[model samples]
Target: MGEKLKLYGFNNLTKALSFNIYDVCYAKTAREQKDYIAYIDEQYNSERLTNILTTLTDMIGAKVLNIARQDYDPQGASVTILIAEGSMLPAGETQLAHLDKSHVTVHTYPEYHPETCLATFRVDIDVATCGEITPLSTLDYLIRSFDSDIITMDYRVRGFTRDMNGRKLFLDHKVNSIQDYIEPELLRRYDAVDINVYDANIFHTKMMLKEVDLQNYLFKTDVYELPPKTRLEIMNNLRREMIEIFSGRNIY
Candidate 1:
């Protein structure tokens, strides 16, 4: 590790990481579709999401100051955790006022296309910090925690901090691309793209799974149960959905 630069004061640079993952599956009948949505809701409930965020807080060596979590009535859940660099909290300061800039949040959306028999579960997460810690280190863990078919991430560093001599530093670390922080093994599993603005200290990466296993995308059904032609159709539909999502455009 390079010698740590002594800062004049608290690191004012706010590094924010936001990403969303999509899990696509084929549920044949209406009943199966409903079940798939229900399954996703229960699997990623507020309690479980809170645990994930808490683990992320620990991973980044931050202390959680407060948390607000709720589960929706029909489906989905949301969790937000306010964190600080360490045990430091100003006396008599409100939790939100003191740590509003540093927090982690997650929300889930589960939906289905009855016409195409496709069920999709989407999870959106955000991690922001304003000190020596960064949220980039938790990227791999977050990706691994979910069944991700397509993923898109945005990372940005805002504001500037001063050094010991009062020199402004926009970015404390070197980051040409967000992909630089991702695990190589994980990179090999998906086709990734990067759109970065180096001058502004912003980076974006989008990934789509390279290979699709028939069994993995099926819900309460076996590949063998699908006739050869039906299997081909389902695979095509699934691929199309993923591509459309990855491209952010509807395909003809």
Candidate 2:
């Protein structure tokens, strides 16, 4: 745990956490792919996403000032919530103007490849705050909120705040790596990597599930129904898809 720094005034350091979570599935037919996408759209619609963000806002000890959410046509959804420190604001003070600067947002992307029969649903979330409250506390809850197969996260602290003696403090807390904040049990379930710039106060972590249960990745398809050879092929294809996404490139 890092010691709390006694700041000269309100801590203006902006700490932001950005996350990308992916859920992959194998949909054998066109209908299955369409259905998979539709299912994701409904499962994570604006209403649901707003709930998640609001919960996250509470976890970080912030108050939601306003919310803007929309469910897109065909597929996808987006939710944005403006937040402020838990303290009550002065009379006639409006927090709406800070919507663009300090807020929690989430957007979903659900798509599939017709030829490959691989469907992927991606959720991008961002939490930015400019005060004593930090978004790091909500990491565990956010990770467990979705069926994440691969996850990439970036956390950075920007700007500077003054100490009692007027010395500048770039980061109020210590962060060796983003992985340090994740639960050890959760870390054991996945292979994780880190790319951090300590001087710049930037941290990045990417994770991919190490174990694959065939039935879990199949959409409306029974694992036992497929022949042994077919099962092996499906498993390989799924693994390949996960690898491609984890590496952020086409395997070939």
Candidate 3:
């Protein structure tokens, strides 16, 4: 932490944070796969997602100007909130298409392998602010809101704000790595990697949970029901899938 810069005008610097998470599941039968999707849809529907974003808005110390939410056909949901850093917008002027300051959005995908029993629930969230608010403050809370096996995050500070003396400051605060903001307890559970471009003000971090328990990945099934060999095969397939996702490439 350092001394706050005295800005001449509204802090024009824009900081954006994107958080993405993957929850893997093993649904061995056709019925199980259907149930998995159904469960995901229910757990993260439009209503619940909106509630989460509302709490996030509070966490970042921003005011919600407007919100547009929808639950898609068959599956998935989307919620977008237009926020303000200071005073609320003039009455009767609330629309997202013209918003350029602060906002929060969430998109969910309930998908499964075509030929395999592997299923994955993915949620992508973006929180961008233009004034004094910083999205990094809400990182841990957002991660804890989901059931994650793998987490990938990207944070970038864009544009510039002027100091009291009219000098342009690219970044208002100091941040060497996104990992620095993550809580120690959560950090201990995952293997992490960082690829950052400090000069450009962009930082990326990806993490994969270190421990894998078969029961956690199984859907509507138990380890005791499957033969020992089948259980081992399931565990291997799950591990391989997780590794490939964490590495962002296929394993040959």
Ranking by lDDT: 1, 3, 2
Q: What tens digits encode model 3's per-residue C-alpha lDDT throughout 160-211? A: 9898888999999999899899899988899999999999999999999999
TM-score of 3: 0.94
Residue pairs that clash (backbone atoms under 3 angstroms), model 2: none
TM-scores, all models, native as reference: 0.95, 0.94, 0.94
Order of all candidates by TM-score, from best down to worst? 1, 2, 3
Clashes of each: 0, 0, 0
lDDT of 2 by residue, 1-252 (tens): 367778897888999999999999998999999999998899999999999999998888888888999999989999999888755433465633342257999999999988778999999999999878788888788889995999999999999999999999898887898888888888888999999999899999999999999999889999998899988988888899999899999984
Positional deviation of 54 in candidate 1, in angstroms?
Answer: 0.3
lDDT by candidate, in order shown = 0.91, 0.88, 0.89
Off by over 4 Å in 3: 88-100
lDDT per residue, candidate 1, 1-252, as tens digits? 156779996778899999899999999999999999999899999999999999999999998889999999899999999898764665555443354369999999999999999999999999998888889999899999995999999999999999999999999988888888889999899999999998999999999999899999999998999899999999999999999999889985
- Greater lDDT among 1 and 3 belongs to 1
Q: What lDDT would candidate 3 get against the real structure?
A: 0.89
